[model samples]
Target: MDAKQTNGGRRHFLKTGAAAGLALKVGVTAAEPRASTPALPMPEYEKLDALALASAIREGRLTALEALEAAIARAEARSQINAVALRHFDLARENAQRLSRMGRAERAAWAQTAPLAGVPFALKDLGVAMKGTVTTQGCAFFKDAVADHDSTLVQRYRAAGLNIFAKTTTPEFGQTATTESRLFGLTRNPWNLAYSAGGSSGGAAAAVAAGIVPAAHASDGGGSIRIPSSHCGLFGLKPSRGLVPMGPKMLEGWLGLSAQNVISRSVRDSALLLQLTQGPEAGSRTGPQPGALIDAITRPPRRLRIALMEQNPFGAPVHPECLDAVRAAARLCESLGHVVEMAAPKLAIGEMFGSMGIATAAGMLASVRMREKETGRTAREDEFEPLNWRSLQLARGYSAEQAFTARTVFDQAARTVDLFLGEYDLILSPVTAAPAPLLGAMSLDQPYESFVKVAMTASPFTAIFNMTGHPAMSVPLHWNGAGMPIGAQFAAPFGAEATLLALAAQLEQAAPWKDRRPVL
Candidate 1:
């Protein structure tokens, strides 16, 4: 379809379907779609996940170039979503053509060995840096900053034969729960254009949900992956600290709270991506001992001991829909033979929050300084959104002793979680305190205190796992009355991604969400 035709249809779909579906939760009831809408065959690559796409390409029914072109077309068709930060279609075309030229035997061999071979993927603009690409961390200052070499993680992604064709949007410096930046405008939810897609991996989430690709790169340093996955109805796993590399430029992100992974429709795709892209690169300070995540998902998990947190620990008012989603997931687990009981690790809540705040502030400040050094100039007020600028100013004033004490508190909390996990194999909770909020609800232009309040309230559950360095995933098992997805989160103890993936895979089997496509 032409641009005008695509835009008109998108407007109609967003208004008629997304706006109307708000009255009923998505998974609970079906909305009446226009009867006049004709059924069209979905493109072969768009219908297949990464593994399936590779299988088709290897079997000679589809070529790598065909898959790339299909994805590029979908991305172009979904232009109304505003998910892309930058496009690399020309470079991707080059790569796809080269891959297509390989002998049939060579292609088949690579398909069997390289998990994501010939799959088109988008890199989250936050931290999955590509060589010579504009690796903007959702900041205007970094818009012109190009990467001199591939990040260690990016190298691994390329090595797996995934074709990188685009970069997705993120919040400035990835400091917020929402994905709106001064550089890139809003990244809207695919399910409902009026709602958020979650961030700083919002662009990646939107792209995948809109079928631009089966999966895309994402990072979570405070729920960048899971939050967006929750909002967009995709599977997102934040692997344990040290499981994914931070790389040649840095050992850790946000003091090891950040992790790299992908947001995907299928559990096996996420698990396989983790298996292939995980492990420490050279100069790594911390990472878990490598484990077989892909293998673990091949079978159902044993009856497991699970602890369920039904309410927000910080006393934030969780939306009733989020609460209901967790309860339903808990019931599903019970029916599946897993034991679920109300439990949470005893924590010094006030101190942990304070420490988290301090550490977070310090990390943001450090990143800003690093960028200033890179650019060799001070940041202008015009270059940052109000909240980021204020946070940087405040964090700059934090004393070393204060930062150290915050780290100590986080460490203590981690230790407490370790002890708590000794009694349970996994913990279940709501990924966010609420569903995807309206645009500008969590804007960085809000006052600093208000921004923090919104950010913390929207993302209470996921950041704790980041601090504790546990493996956590947001499973899209529920949708609210407004048809917005509210994910149920599951976190396993440190270095136990295998357990989590197996359980996620089993859950996927029990309630298959693969066919649940968005209206827009």
Candidate 2:
């Protein structure tokens, strides 16, 4: 490559690019155009998940090293878009050693030969899962903070024999919407590095979107999982409040709105992983739900009822393309023999956003307090992103008298879904008000409260399910002009994962994301 006409061109960035080896695909060929800019080894890994990689390993088409090499290389090229906070290549290689020792049949049988068995995977560093790994929480506040134990989801992934490849980034205390944090800078979207991947699971979504890993663990409270998932074009779900357990930390998250799940390329993968990990971990909210979330996916959903609204009910305009996509899905449902009608129960976007703000801000303050208490440290208001600190401040503004009213609003909204759900199998809506935003689009410079407002445009519909404690899944049903993914959310009633999974699986079979990938 010739020297750039300008000193600050991509060429200059390449010299100081400073990509970590373990972050992206490793074996990128030099022939590629982006190769001059330190591209990841292979672009293909951007599209393939652990399950597919496992298949290649079994088929003798690709070795784990080949896969890992490719992933690390991609991280080098794409890390700027979605910063990968931690690398465990040594541990991952150790896990691969065990996988290499196992007979294919043994590994496959144990995986139930499940799709992801023996595949490489990653975890969001936010939750507790020491793995002797860094849990930066996107903060300078806890730069040295390391978890002492694995979160339940980590244990489940290990048991399933998924190689723990890397740790993705997140916002501090996951307080804000975009993925940027002081600890690791920012995680940009693959489609446009200038745009955000969406947060606090933004790093997780970015990694998956950039092809660093096929799928990664993420948690959603006020759209942490789904928002990034939507932005990154991966399938993301916030399992019903209790379907996936959150224990050893708190029995319920965000007053039971948050839950652990993943952003994946396929619905069955989400269902499959949830089946593997979800259940009543001791101290989980409510007892185990039913037979199994995985088995639940195989059965055909009964001829269902569906409510479809192509417009953002909150008065925000759904990008015309997104509106068309939702309408198309409704038409598809109609073709498949389900009842599809335009019915949107009255919902106030402002009230819902306000309640979500309190929940998010309160959670941030709790994390800050916990950090300070445990480490003998205190955070000045300036240490945090203003939006996050202000969220806490706003949360403090409410009185006990207001709490009841907020609860009433949350419960009433959620219950409306319950009642509406009784008449419909699932409610289909745009996952975000629009497509992924440019980086700094949701920047902290805006009034703290305004962040929530801007966030509502794409994320408004998601929090409703969290409020009601119903299971919600985001499916990658549409792609924009840029080939970036846009997801449509399907929400089911409380304890209705069985219902949702069954429906999701059918959709997966009908339209798969298995072969779709970006040019990493």
Best-matching candidate per lDDT = 1
Residue-level lDDT of model 2, residues 279-394, one tens digit each, is 78876547447447777776778888888866675766778767755666676667667787777666766787677666666666677778899799787776777766666677
Per-residue C-alpha lDDT of model 1 across residues 1-520, encoded as one tens digit per residue: 4546644653453334332221212132343242232222233344467877766556554568877987888787778888998999999999999888776688878866676778899998876568888888888877887888898888888888899999998888787877888788998898989888898899999999988988999999888899999999899999999888887787787777788999998888898888888897888766678898888988889999999987787886888888988998999999899999999987777887677777767777786788889989998889888877887788888898997787787788889999999999999999998788887889888876766667776778888888888889999888777767889999998999999999998888787787677876
TM-score between model 1 and native = 0.91
Candidate 1 clash pair list: 242-287
**What's model 2's lDDT at 104?**
50
Each candidate structure's TM-score, on Cα atoms with residue i matched to residue i, is 0.91, 0.84
How accurate locally, in lDDT, is each candidate? 0.82, 0.70
Error of 1 at 432 (Å): 1.1
Model 2: worst 10 consecutive residues (lDDT sum): 17-26
